[model samples]
Target: MAGHATVPSSPEPSSLRALPPSAKLVVKTLEYEGRLTQAELVESTRLPDRTVRYALRELEDEDLVTSRISFADARQRVYSLTTAES
Candidate 1:
């Protein structure tokens, strides 16, 4: 251990582990895709709108994801992972 760097147990919390698989997938998608609308998330994840909505809600509840009104389309919302901020 003298020459080796220490590693943390986990980057994520136990609460994340309790979330549904769909929520996890949404998180990953946002991490890679940056920000996306609900319809775009459906296309990227190939999941139904209802599933994506539920996942987004769960992510929001966990404070893992953030959303804002889309400048391009005021009626739609854009979502992104909070951790992505630099």
Candidate 2:
């Protein structure tokens, strides 16, 4: 019988290290919930509004998350993990 090759079971350390703890939390929330508004993200992460906004901005800059005006309320903005990140 031929032996099967073993596959790596974990993500690269560099990839994990690149994300800050808050960013990780935000990503996880978005991934689990599909889509969320900025307020919702703040609630979900239990983070301060400034922290949530900072994380969202960093994620957006990294192309990890995308945002657009909410159809239900133009005054509000919705956010979600990008397809590549998801």
Candidate 3:
């Protein structure tokens, strides 16, 4: 924990207000589903591939989500809400 930076315990309304609707949907999906891959997010959120990708990038920029390589498939990445945001 030494080198890790702490985020606010709750999301800031101003920040969330600035995000696109797709990004908000992605966040809600992750919150409900725990964690999911890009494909899963698309399935769960009914969002297009490109939109999911864009949303993920936006979430990452806000430090609201983090990604890790899937253990079952090296080619896939799974995403989840960060502890602070979760």
Where does candidate 2 have its weakest 10-residue lDDT segment?
4-13
Candidate 2 TM-score over all chains jointly: 0.76
TM-score, predicted candidate 1 vs. hidden true structure? 0.82
- Candidate 1 C-alpha lDDT tens digits along 1-86: 69653332221667679899888888777766678999999999999999999999988888788899999999999998776642
1-86 per-residue lDDT for model 3 (tens digits): 69644433435567789999999888777776676899999999998999999999998999888999999899999998886434
Model 2: pairs clashing at backbone N, Cα or C within 3 Å: none
Encode model 2's per-residue lDDT on 1-86: one tens digit a residue: 26643322323345446777897788778777767898999999999989989888887887778898999999999987676334
TM-score of each: 0.82, 0.76, 0.82
TM-score of 3: 0.82
Q: What value does the lDDT take at residue 31 in candidate 1?
A: 68
Who wins the lDDT comparison? Answer: 3
- How many pairs of residues collide in each model? 0, 0, 0
- As a whole number from 0 to 100, the lDDT of residue 67 in candidate 3 is 96
